[model samples]
Target: MEATRLEPRTLVNGDMVAIVSPASWPEESVPAWIARQVESWGLHAVIAPHTLDRRGYLAGSDADRAADLNQAIRDPEIRAVIASVGGCGSFRLVPDVDVDALRADPKMLVGYSDITALHQVWNAAGVPTLHGAIAGAHGDHVRRLLMEDADTVVEADRGALSAELTTSGSVEGRLFGGNLEMLARSVGVVDFDVAGGILLLEINRAAGLGMVDRALTQLRYSGALDGVVGVALGSIDQFAGYEDRGWTIVDTLRDHFDALGVPVLGGLPLGHIEDLVTVPLGTAAVLDVDHGRLTVDSPSGD
Candidate 1:
């Protein structure tokens, strides 16, 4: 299938950006601080009505979270949608989303971790979204991407980041991937397709080697690994008892993925980490593993 690249909507001064909690609601202090930071960017920040509501582990009921997300996608005035935080529950709201509406009016959709569900949804709908920092991210990180086009290789500090040309040259393809766990859950559901595309993935506290192994196994078993053009591994942050593990996480995965015959780079500063880099999912990008960089092409006619 030919890749469809979506043009990024420019954020004019005074434009509004909706901040919604599609996954988890951040603590009161953090969300408040984030809001102030957004306003400083010259773009108005409109926090969704239920962004602060909490129902156990979720930001709110599934319907409530889904409603805010849907409303943000359809809101013409809102040029971008930033997630509040990512814990869990975003997947529960995916089936309820109106993919057609989102596709009709695509904009910047940014978040990581649990927000992977939305990435998959947008990918299947042929819309490009961003897998990057949420509203709860550090103020500087959020401000950087919103201000202008950013170019930097992001990787976890502990994990190794390597730029090696595994393939003879670079290939441009649509970006598709997110949190390993959330992506694993979408394996055979007909929504996740990794074929002939660049896969950008990262994990968080649940970085047990076994957990990573299981998730990768699921991707391999479900035929999602077939024809994957390249693999970009983002930060796999502090794992519970990760230090106790005898082998480094990157080394373990490297042994497994080496045979895939595609470029695999690590140390992407993404996932549940500070200074996260935003990647536009479903967009065409040139993955130059040889030169150690990924360049997102300006959407056609932009």
Candidate 2:
């Protein structure tokens, strides 16, 4: 396995977290709601200067958004950095990020969807991130990881996870994946280490069945899934939209993933779900398909 990441020191009740927007703009009330939510965890929330700034669809200009994120990453008082929401502009901000400072002062970064680009950047810098929202049921999981410990274990099954097994077996490897589309977009551009890892995927939009199939097919063609040990599928919000004249998303999933000959388990309450669960990206994990479990092996240290 590749060298595991060195997670930052866990936050405490008195620590502070910075909320910024590197992607599209969130609702006017979102940042405030997130601030309140973080405060409830006993941690103060520092809303970045440009967090709510608007420039068309993005929270702000690419430079400004990147600045907000870079500032949060460089701030010593910030115990954690979370995105306010996900949109299209994050990928554009990646180039301007202060990668050097981020590496020197690594802190937890959490978000999903377009934030997947940011997560990939952090993971590459040896900082694992939580894949979930900053608010709601899944946010609780993110809070626990930040305030408590990284040496933790997470499980899924019929009770906590309403998943179905397309192929059944067991396997263990580092966890890698987020928004399927974002991940696929990074196939050539980002050095995503999917090799020998359990790929976790979820859908945020009901784009189309063809697009979904094409994305997965692209991943396969790019050899991004090469040596991948298993696949843990997460929530597909509005999944019914893909059903057309008997052709469902499930059929599409089985078509693409089953051929990989790896354990494929779907129905995880993760990403774009009614209840999102925080999933650590670029961490060693295990997937037991037969038992319907995906356990994150939160290590003690690097």
Candidate 3:
């Protein structure tokens, strides 16, 4: 966990960035629209061949999706890689990631949700990545980080969130984490140990509080959080059933992590939030729970 020597690569106006579908296929018009956004920023957006392929719930056959991502990772001219969207199928593409290829010529890997699997893969190999959208909410944040390699501070209104926390201390460590369910599934399947790092968790869906409890409990029991010092919670989007039970998702989360005895800061506008603030995974950061601030100590992507 020493500082990653994977020096940041710059993205100029003419640089080519690849948008590949690594999970479920996106709607017909999405990739092109995302490409236009990239193009508007003065970078060439190359939609990877299989970005639109549809194969049941996946973007394409596992091999095809993997080939697209591997080629994008290995391509000398593609300066960055973005997932078209997050869906149920990304874990299936994990085996085809070609980590060695990513290690040799690491580029900026960006996306969230299902993309968390790919982010962990690259981060484990010492390459940093952006846990943000490929477009829309915070696309400019992504563009700025990939282009400027800037330090950032993320804060959110604690009163407006469906999340909660415990403790009142500060935790300093490298920042890492993504979709809560995806992270829970990553245990044993991928190298996602959050030990010695501040875990960032965001949820896109939850059937009920019980399901969230089970997911977090599973992650804890699997030893994936062996030495984790703290957690920074972000968007818990689209979850149901808290209101009817006279509770909140925050209450459920608090009950789950209270025993860990670490600072837990919630209300970060990350993951699937409308005003998403792009965060650099695997970068050094300080989580000040008392003040509710997350300060990125290093230039994201650097």
Which candidate number maximizes TM-score? 3
Tell me the spans in candidate 2 whose CA falls farther than 4 Å from its real position.
150-162, 299-302
Q: TM-score, each model?
A: 0.85, 0.92, 0.93
Q: Give the poorly placed runs of model 1, Cα more than 4 Å off.
A: 134-169, 237-247, 298-302
Off by over 4 Å in 3: 240-247, 297-302
- Per-model CA lDDT versus the true structure: 0.71, 0.78, 0.80
Q: Which ten residues in a row have the lowest lDDT in candidate 2?
A: 157-166
Worst 10 residues of 3 by lDDT: 158-167
Q: What is the C-alpha RMSD of each candidate to the true structure, in Å?
A: 3.4, 2.3, 2.1
Candidate number with the higher lDDT (2 or 3): 3
Candidate achieving the largest lDDT:
3
Candidate 1 — which pairs collide? 154-268, 154-269, 155-267, 155-268, 155-269
Give the clashing residue pairs of candidate 3, or none. Answer: none
